[model samples]
Target: MYYEDPILKLEDFSLNIGNTKILKNLDLDIYPGEIILLYGPRNSGKSSLLRSFVHLNEELYNNVEGVGGIYFLGKSVFDLDRKYLRSQITYSDPTFVENLNFLTLKEILNLSLGLKLKDISKEYFSILEKLGISKIFSDLDNLKEYNSLKNWSIGEKISLITFISLARRPKVFIFDSILDHLDDFLLEDVKDILYRIKEDRTLIISTRNFSLFSDIAERVVFLDDGKISFAGKTESFIINYPK
Candidate 1:
């Protein structure tokens, strides 16, 4: 397959928030069809880096310095239309929790497609059914009515939210600590989805959970205290930073 320019690129990017330097001259590029793992302990500036890429922190946006780039399919994310850029660079954090209240699986899927209020794909639900998750919403009414009034397991909630993410299939997908809360079985399913998406989109996952990335990620970058401590092949990362 002919390759395109970097789907997302960051070079010499640095951020200073409230007198604290969050990122120090970080450089990285993510090509299409690659899955990268960003692993580091809590408060290591992983979230800060994400904010910079997606333009989430308005206050910090002006303070960010460096000749870095954030792109979606060869177009600079900053240069592209904001709403259009958001459609391509989908960032899913723990805060996607609001999606949990979506009730039925179909409703959740519909909600995502409705985000841009774009055209609903006819085959979107078909993908869900193929992934063995369709049964979760076999009964749409009950699923939508499912409430926090009724306690659901973390595993179930994660599974539903993840399926919706896969359904969207953004060009640059970002996940922050998403799989840490999932069980092994569900984690495997999520991995399968990531692998399937590899042929078309780039996956950027940030998590402290290293084992999950050992087999899925081609490159591993370690972040420590707002700096890159290490970057290399996944196997080498495990051999050197064995938990």
Candidate 2:
């Protein structure tokens, strides 16, 4: 399905970190329910650009200076409350999963909704089954005993993080350099989950593994030295920037 309305817009967006320029004159529009792939080598500003959308927190904007503006659902991102913006536009990275070690899978799942374990709906269990993590749920007691994401495999960590993100049901989801960490099987599962959930929300992912998502993403935004070097359909990007 095609969405005509723009869900996010960047107007002459530029970012500078100390003496270095990260992004330059970026003007882009993101449509709702569209899957966008942001790809480039390291330091191309893919992560920085993704972080800009939820820059209400000082941690993201501390060392950076943005000249232009970023608008989400027609409002400037800077004007939105930090917590509100974070709830609306969720950002997930590998490190995000590491922090979940303190909480059990049930607690982590209910974290976003502020629901008690007993209060969690049956739908949550249904989602866990659909994601093929019913085994993990069944072993919830044992898994909780680990008490640290450090004990889990990379695939398990990513899967759990993806599940938590989906449970949030945010309008926009941002993933940073996460696809490269998964094995082929886990990658396929993650992609399947993304496909099912993306029908209602926008997905912006940054990864060096461009070919993995080439067929799934509607648009591809290639960054070079902090500026968008190419922005168009997935096929066009592959053709023009041939790996």
Who wins the TM-score comparison? 2
Mark the regions of model 1 whose C-alpha exceeds 4 Å error after superposition. 1-4, 59-67, 98-111, 115-133, 147-152
- The TM-score of candidate 1 is 0.81
Query: Clashes per prediction?
Result: 2, 0
Candidate 1 per-residue lDDT, tens place, 100-143, comes to 65454445545566532133344655555544555444554545
Cα lDDT of model 2 by residue, 68-143, tens digit: 8799999998888978988999898767766767766556655667655455467876766655565655545855
lDDT of 1 at 148: 45
Worst 10 residues of 2 by lDDT: 131-140
- The model with the greatest lDDT is 2
Model 2: number of backbone collisions: 0
Clashing pairs for model 2 are: none
lDDT of each: 0.70, 0.79
Q: lDDT of model 2 at residue 232?
A: 93
